[model samples]
Target: MTFKHALMAATLAALVGNAFAAEDRMPPIPADKLSDAQKKSIELLSEGAPAGGAPRNVGAGPWVPLLRSPELLNRLQRMGSYLRYESAFDPRLSEFVILLTARDWSNQYEWLAHQKLALKAGVTPAVTQAIAEGRRPTGMTADEEMVYDFIDELLRNRSVSDPTYARIKDRFGERGVIDLIAINGYYSMLAAVLNVAQSPLPGGAPQQIPTLPR
Candidate 1:
């Protein structure tokens, strides 16, 4: 096949796979078929999106399943807009937290979506690769390390240690601390939805993060 043809084929295959995966659960609803509330949710999701950002379709990432509950989807997009774009942490650190949450959840779609964002936001390739492999990434800056430890302890222990909490609060302020916690919780909630939905990675990409042995 020609390169263009090959790419188209891959995309079609991926769509087919996603259809099969989502049909029994929260299947993608076509725009034309969406209810008024669902359409509103899509509109809200698109309100602040960049000129050429992610698709406004129900099939895009978490929106597919989330569309089922338009109010939830709308609320989530509002909250996510703040956490993703206006969070106290730098974009690099925000994306690093997102990637870490994705890794922890083994959510392939989440990882696929944010890995590039993480890199583009200034997270080093080495750090991302280490996180993908479930290792303590070396070379993270002091702040990055602190953020990592904060989330790591929170996820593993169900609460941040006193020291970890203090470090982030000192560095980023109480708002930063709250944003940090909110980002983790927010992404984790999305991960749970995607996991329950068995959302496939876009374009038939192979899973990047390995499932932990448990």
Candidate 2:
């Protein structure tokens, strides 16, 4: 299948997985809540996700699976998978982008999920810990610092300075930089959804998001 289609399928799987998991124990709203916009958005989100742009869902607290509906879920699944399945950038760079944003945002779930992925991506433990803690890791090798610095620059400015941009260009070439940016943007969207939804870290136990100076 095509890249977009594959991504949508993944989200569809997550949504379908949860479809039968509800009961009357579902949380009460006291009085019916949700503005009309939110209700419609939620419905659209579930109908199938699109190919990138906005999060699949961004409601506060618990939510019906946004991808439960085949249409919306399929659209988002495509976007999520397409962004994640790039081939030009070194996969390690993708993980670094994810780790950097997760750390910058002080998002516990994002950090927790990416930490292992970072390590598996060949990032050292010290560097992974530093990234997870929002500390500028002095742990990178000279060659490796280029990627870390690129992520750090983006986290700081939400855009790159000329010198950093030049270095990234030299190292990763144009496609790599674009992929890196997309990687960060993709995770940023995820962090927003996870935070607003109050989704805990992947496992059931609660963990605190690290405090950042902002």
Candidate 3:
């Protein structure tokens, strides 16, 4: 390449690198700059296994930006605690719902964070791969397929059909059905926030979900 062309390319690469480095617009507030409410929120967030375990540091993932609205964060985290840990669905199913929401929103951070949990919770690699690729996963258990179909329809149509709703309700009971929907909705909201903030994965980890064509 010509000298001028090489220099231009070098500058372009630097800009891209900086963009990735600074992708998380809501970087953590320094301790000194934290407001009283923000400080209190940190305590509440760190107090328990909300979302199965609070972040070791309050500055991670959705928590970083969420810390800005301390009361909201506190409330949301409590709700998440119940939904994630106390909900009727099994861990595998919970993570599966979360992954579905993440993919539906194309929220890379959520997918990156939960895909492992889903697998560890026993969601099959083949199932996750299919979800990641926007295809219907094959070989899911009868229960997994039921949950998948219910969530898939809900996300796509913004409403579940009577038959779909009845199928889930009959298998899991009303509480189970609600818990399933709640998990999907909760993650969907988080995904929206993360996507709007363009939240970056921790430690500059590479983004896994490709941006869909507009």
Scored by TM-score, the top model is: 3
Q: Write the per-residue lDDT of candidate 1 for residues 178-198, one digit (tens) a residue.
A: 999999899999999988987
Query: Model 1 reaches what TM-score against the true structure?
Result: 0.84
Query: Which regions of candidate 2 fall more than 4 Å away from where they truly are?
Result: 1-65, 68-73
Evaluate residue 165 in candidate 1 and report its C-alpha lDDT on the 0 to 100 scale: 93
TM-score for predicted model 3 compared with the true structure: 0.86
Q: Write the per-residue lDDT of candidate 3 for residues 1-214, one digit (tens) a residue.
A: 6544654564566456546564667788899999999999998877877544745456667888888789999899889888888899988999999988888887878888889999999999999988876668999999999999999898778899999999999999999988998999899988888877767777767756544322
User: Which residue pairs overlap in candidate 3's backbone?
Assistant: none
> Would you estimate the TM-scores of all the predictions?
0.84, 0.63, 0.86
lDDT of 2 by residue, 41-64 (tens): 566555543333344333322233
Superposed Cα deviation of residue 211, candidate 1 (Å): 1.1
Q: Quantify all predictions' global Cα lDDT against the true fold.
A: 0.82, 0.59, 0.82
Summing lDDT over every window of 10 consecutive residues in candidate 2, give the lowest-scoring window: 22-31
Q: What lDDT score goes with residue 188 in model 1? A: 94
At residue 49, candidate 3 shows an lDDT of 78
Local error of candidate 3 at 191, Å? 0.8
